[model samples]
Target: MRIDLTNIPSEGKSLHFTLTPDWWKSDLDEDRLMGLEAPLSASIKLYPAGKKIAVEGSLSTRLVMRCDRCLEPYGWDLSTDFRIYLSIAPFKGELDVELSEDDLSLDFIDGEFLDPAQIIREQIILSVPMKTLCRKDCKGLCPVCGCNLNMTRCSCSSTYETSLYQNS
Candidate 1:
């Protein structure tokens, strides 16, 4: 989503974007985000100041996730509110900033325009979970018998303990 600076108010800019499920359904190498869908609506808030803009917004959508226990594919809703700073450059080396946060990285743009789509894609990727599970009590498939204990209910819960030397 590209916001024209002329449309922004002097005080602040507020935009309401209707992001459909198809927006996330792109041909990009979304393998990491495969099966993730964004069939929902979201809003973005813009605060523009001196060739720079601060963005904050929230979005909720269904995304693909793997079951942490059984390693199965599952779809679920993910909600996240992100804040970022964007800048449009009129000339090269025109933007600079001093570090204040413990871990803050700056990305400089040499273009005269700003595209929020790139930032949105980055935020979506960062928002994904490293590990997902259908439930906390999920019992994965048996290692030897190859049976999902959560569904099979076998009495093979006993396994070798590698921490036997820790107590000694």
Candidate 2:
């Protein structure tokens, strides 16, 4: 999970990692991510940028998620690619100093190591869909009976049917 900065050569390095659900359980739960299905895998490339280290990588995994509409569990495939710049130099002077756009992409390394697992965990959480649905045409659940509209017709449908026939 942690890589030694001293090992990174000026010519750059390529690294791959595999992780399990246990490694991300804490962060996933904090983000309310439910039902992880398989192992997480990633491939990363590190480049030396003067005093800064540049990291670029991609992560992929399968997850079991609940449908927001039907309340049913379903499987989803997730993949994401990201790039970040890391520096060992701490910003000096005032703690409340203002930062420019260039500072936004810069991440300060606390020591001489980088935690790739932590970065992958954050990226996974950010990739989660805002609105999760099992399908595009999901009818959702019946409000009164709490029945799945996609599975069976609820008693409420009969009431509407009777009213329509009575008016004829």
Candidate closest to the true structure, highest TM-score? 2
Tens digits of lDDT, candidate 1, 1-168:
555643467677666655665566443533445555556556677677666677777776787766755666667787788877665545662444332343333432323333555445556666767756666666666655666666775555446111322322
RMSD vs true structure, all candidates: 5.5, 6.8
Q: Candidate 1 versus the native: TM-score?
A: 0.64
Tell me the tens digit of each residue's lDDT in model 2 across 63-85: 77778877887778998898876
Clashing pairs in 2: none
Give candidate 2's error at residue 133 in angstroms: 0.9
Q: What stretches of model 1 exceed 4 Å from their correct place?
A: 5-8, 25-33, 89-110, 153-168
List ranges where model 2 is wrong by over 4 Å: 26-32, 90-110, 157-168
User: For model 2, how many clashes?
Assistant: 0
